[model samples]
Target: MVDNVSKQERSNIMRKVRSQSDLENVVSKALWKKGIRYRKNVKSLMGKPDIVIQKYKIVIFIDSCFWHACELHGRMPKSNTEFWESKFERNKERDAEVNKHYLSKNWNILRVWEHELREDFDGTINKIVAFIEHAKK
Candidate 1:
């Protein structure tokens, strides 16, 4: 199956192939343990958030530091600076567009960078839990 697609096309489909971070996995587990249920990437939703709580009107995005341009850890690769720059820029644009679209529909957006979330899983979860709780009210 992997060999069926051209390398470039495969890259486009597998773009931003960052694996789930410890923070996301841990926090997600914790949330589940707390009986908080959410959907992962509803195709109908813009940007296909990592976590979406439709009832609570909340969306969560766990962005990779490298892919989403982590404020602290984001770095430009020297190998193909132009290509990476364009890619990152496009990602940023799409993110902003999706964010705006979600907001327009009265959905609260939470974007957590990989570095921040992994480095501080508890705090991140706390924020999400709190958001969900507040949204319920």
Candidate 2:
């Protein structure tokens, strides 16, 4: 299917897409308030994790339902079915690859879904804190 927008317009729209999301900002701020120091989007990392604690060998990924194709909430775009399908499939594959790489290196990895955070913000925060604390041990 052809794109709805002009080539230049599509380029501009894609350019506006950011590597960091507001969800990441909120979660990072909450963690910071709890005295959990971490780095954001370390490009040197294998997958460029959203949050990383080098001291503890921890990596956290805040995955959007749409982007990561959450089983429960992900929906294919009506406009570009084939493109979105391929994109989502690739995303899931890459996630698995990243998980494998971290596991092989003995790094603690946590992936929080968008709906999970939205459903229970405080609970999710606590879960993350617990995960980090456990990794510290």
Candidate 3:
């Protein structure tokens, strides 16, 4: 029984998800400290990549599990299955387009789910580092 303000608050809460969480931030900081420089939230990019390393031509996207439909933890909401599935599918298609576009342009793309960030901070960073390092060669 929520009123307008409370309903709006709940909607806002549900709709909110930041690009760079503390886990990603910490990993970015560690990588930076080790002499890695990357651009954060480059709007010029089609997908607004979360992190970009120009030197290695690498772009990172910190995708939300709910939005990107993380294969593991992305459960279809039972409340509004049709609406949620459509939304999630659209997001997935858009992600594929962005990834393809970047690949065509010779830019390496990295998409890490929010769950991955929470579960494995350093390991996730390592995956990105490995890609960038390989591109560096």
Q: Would you estimate the TM-scores of all the predictions?
A: 0.81, 0.96, 0.80
lDDT of 2 at 32: 100
Using lDDT as the yardstick, the better of models 2 and 3 is: 2
lDDT of 3 by residue, 1-137 (tens): 22335667758976785655675677678779767788887788798887888777889888877778989888886665677889999999999999999999998888878888679877877877887788888
Residue 135 in model 1: shift from native, Å?
1.3
lDDT of 1 by residue, 34-122 (tens): 78899876779888788889987899998888888776899987655677889999989999998999889988888877776667877
lDDT for position 7 in model 2: 85
lDDT of 2 at 18: 91
Best prediction by lDDT: 2
By TM-score, rank the candidates, best first. 2, 1, 3
Candidate number with greatest TM-score: 2
Candidate 2, lDDT over the whole model: 0.95
Model 2 stretches astray by more than 4 angstroms = none
Q: What is the lDDT of residue 109 in candidate 2?
A: 100
The reply for model 3, stretches above 4 Å from the true place, is 1-11, 14-16
Q: Return the lDDT, model 2, position 117.
A: 94
Q: Judged by lDDT relative to the true structure, which candidate is superior, 1 or 3?
A: 1
- Residues 1-137, candidate 2, lDDT per residue (tens digit)? 76788989978998999989998999999999999999999999988999999999999999999999999999987776898999999999999999999999999999999998999999999999999999999
Please estimate how well model 1 matches the true structure, expressed as its whole-model Cα lDDT.
0.80
